[model samples]
Target: MTMTKKHLDSARRTLELEILALQEQLGQLDHQFDQACDLLLGLTGRVIVTGMGKSGHIGNKIAATLASTGTPAFFMHPGEASHGDLGMVTRQDAVLALSNSGETQEVTSLLPLLKRLGIPIISITGAPYSTLAREATLHLNASISREACPLNLAPTSSTTATLALGDALAIALLEARGFGPDDFALSHPGGSLGRRLLLRVADIMHQDQQVPRVLPQASLREALLEITRTGLGFTCVTNEQNQLLGVFTDGDLRRVLDLSLDLHQTRVDQVMTPEGKRVYPEQLAAEAVHVMEENKISALPVVNQQQQLVGALNMHDLLKAGVI
Candidate 1:
């Protein structure tokens, strides 16, 4: 085989091994997994994850996943726990220890102190009979038939299985806790998901003086001027009571131009899309996006419960807010 072909084969073999390892883990799930989730769910304090070496990296990610999903968690370095960091642990907290061998010295060494504190320990290990597993309050078997590493000496299929197990635990807990998108958005406010779930139309729309609007009797030329002045690409046509009568957009202008309508003589409402698609100020900006996409429109006039035009927003505004 060519060098490139050899490389591809190695990669494929590694993935296949990891896939089988995950399958084994899936079959290993039992009451122990259920009891572990119950313990985590009932905890009054945080989940403190600890490990050594490669296991430590996996532990850090598991802690973060647990934290972001709903269960409060943080990674604690086992070596540091031996050096006074054990003080961070309280009886209210639970320990999640990781060790493929089930006997990493740094991690196993902390088990005694954790037990003395009356803290519950949940261990994920390849060796079911190892010291850490035997000492744990609940043990999860992350065993794999062999490492994906060709020599079977390095951590490969083992870590993949452990990570998958960690994710399974996190998601199961998330579902049990009834964690929903809004709750997730609270923890991820800076991300696009948060913007989609949390952002409201009122938060991004132009209001009052900034809103481009013209009286229904206003000439098409005047509406065009209003659209230009606000740069919102559209203007709302309303009456004396400020009730929305219609909306005229650049596309409407194109069609009107095609008809060769006299812009200065034509009433704004005569050329407007009567009672055009509208959105409420309190509605999610994501919902507004759906309306725009479904109707093939670029802008929406924000209205109140009484159907009075309150504000306006365009596709550009939603795009700028990262809700697009």
Candidate 2:
């Protein structure tokens, strides 16, 4: 199909106008924005965001973002509030009202009750001089000079500005609450992120009797037996103190096979790699994964700082932990 220059020009024009409008709306990040953040952060109960029409949709998304990022928040539709949904907001909570014209009757009607209850009200509107903004303890000016639409009817640029303001509010709350990646993982614990943050080396490592192990003086055949029994590809050789001495792996077995050595007569010390790389028990399973990958090894013997053999973890454990 042949592309026309007229259609491309129209698309580019719309994008440029919206971008400029959004940048113009950045002036809303003033003291009023600070006051709104403070009000929401100081709330004893969840933040209650209320709005009408398209503003309501943006309010819902903002509420969800705040809720997931460690701030407690929820959206309350103004149209529903007129029909008794106002019960969602309480004296302990703070209300963030959104109305482009500041005259959304359904939203404005709740201000009197909110005021009487001493519930702080913050407003997001295009008109800072509007009734809703004037009545609010904090007013965020999400005003745009013109709509991207030619007839000045449709809400294209205005809605985008409102949504960006919502993002700013959510991120401010997230930062002020000290919400970090691990906190985020806690909220989203069923996915890959949860596995990475929550799963530890101890959680996935081979324990006690399951760990492949043999004494330093044990025959290579004995080490092979331990590896075969545990099926973990490696055997740890420890001293009388249960301290790590060396390690013999499947790779060592292949090398010994190349030499045609007598497995029963060959001592493990002769075939083993002494003082092999090891990890601590409390180390992050992800870090263990990095060590294994960097060295091209499949397993690592976990030991204490004093070098006692405590645990063994393999690539399979990391794979299960989603760190691989």
Candidate 3:
């Protein structure tokens, strides 16, 4: 086979082996899994994860996932823990240890100290009877038939199984604790998901003089000037009291142009879309995206509870705010 073909075969074989390892893990789940979840749920403190080498990397990711999903957790490097980092763990915290063979020196060495603190130990290991597993308060089996590595010397299927099991534990805990999207958004406020969940129309809309609006009795030429000045592509037609009456957009101008009406003489109210699709200031920016999408419009007039025009927004505004 060509070198490229040989590489593809190796990759495929590796993936197949890892997939089988995950499938094997599905059968290993027992009441111990439920017990582990119960222990974590009852904890008034954080979940402290620790491991060495490949296991350490997986432990870090698992810790992050657990913390972000509502269960507070952090990764503690086993080697560092033996020095002075052990001070970070308190009796209120539980230890989630990872060791493929369940006997890594760095991880196993901390078991006694953790035990002395009366901390609960949850271990994920390939060997169910290994030192770490046996000493653990609760053990999770992450065993695989063999490594996906051709020589069976490198960590492959084993690491994949351990990571998958960690994810399973986190999601199970997330559901049991009744964690929802809003709670998740609070933890991830800097991300796009948080923006979609937390940002309101009032937060991003152009308001005050920045809002493109004109009186209904104003000439279409005057409304066009407002739209051009504000650069929002649309202008709201409002009454003297600032209540929204209608909206005139680029699309409406195109249609009006087809009739060759005089822009300076025609009233904006006569040509505007009467009581067009609108959004409220307090509505979610994501909801504004939905309304604009459903109505096939690019801009919307923001209204208050009394139907007063308060702000204006367009798809471009949502795009800039990362709501798109």
The lDDT for every candidate, in the order shown, is 0.95, 0.87, 0.95
Error of 2 at 283 (Å): 4.3
Tell me the tens digit of each residue's lDDT in model 3 across 1-324. Answer: 999999999999999999999999999999999999999999999999999999999999999999999999999999999899999998899999999999999999998888988999999999999999999999999999999999998999999999999999999999999999779888989978889988999999998899999998899889889989999889999998999999999999999999999999999999999999999988889999999999899999999989999999999999999998
State candidate 3's TM-score. Answer: 0.92
State the number of backbone clashes in model 3.
0
- Which structure among the candidates has the greatest TM-score? 1
What lDDT tens digits, residue by residue, belong to model 2 across residues 195-221? 777767777888899888888889988
Error of 3 at 282 (Å): 3.2
Rank candidates by lDDT, best first.
3, 1, 2
What shift in Å separates residue 221 of candidate 3 from its native position after superposition?
A: 2.2
User: Which model is ahead, 2 or 3, in terms of lDDT?
Assistant: 3
Q: Which portions of model 2 show Cα errors greater than 4 Å?
A: 1-22, 145-156, 219-221, 249-277, 280-284, 290-297, 304-307, 321-324
- Lowest summed lDDT window (length 10), candidate 2: 1-10
lDDT of 1 by residue, 160-223 (tens): 9999999999999999999998899889988888899999999999998989999988999999
Which order, best to worst by TM-score?
1, 3, 2
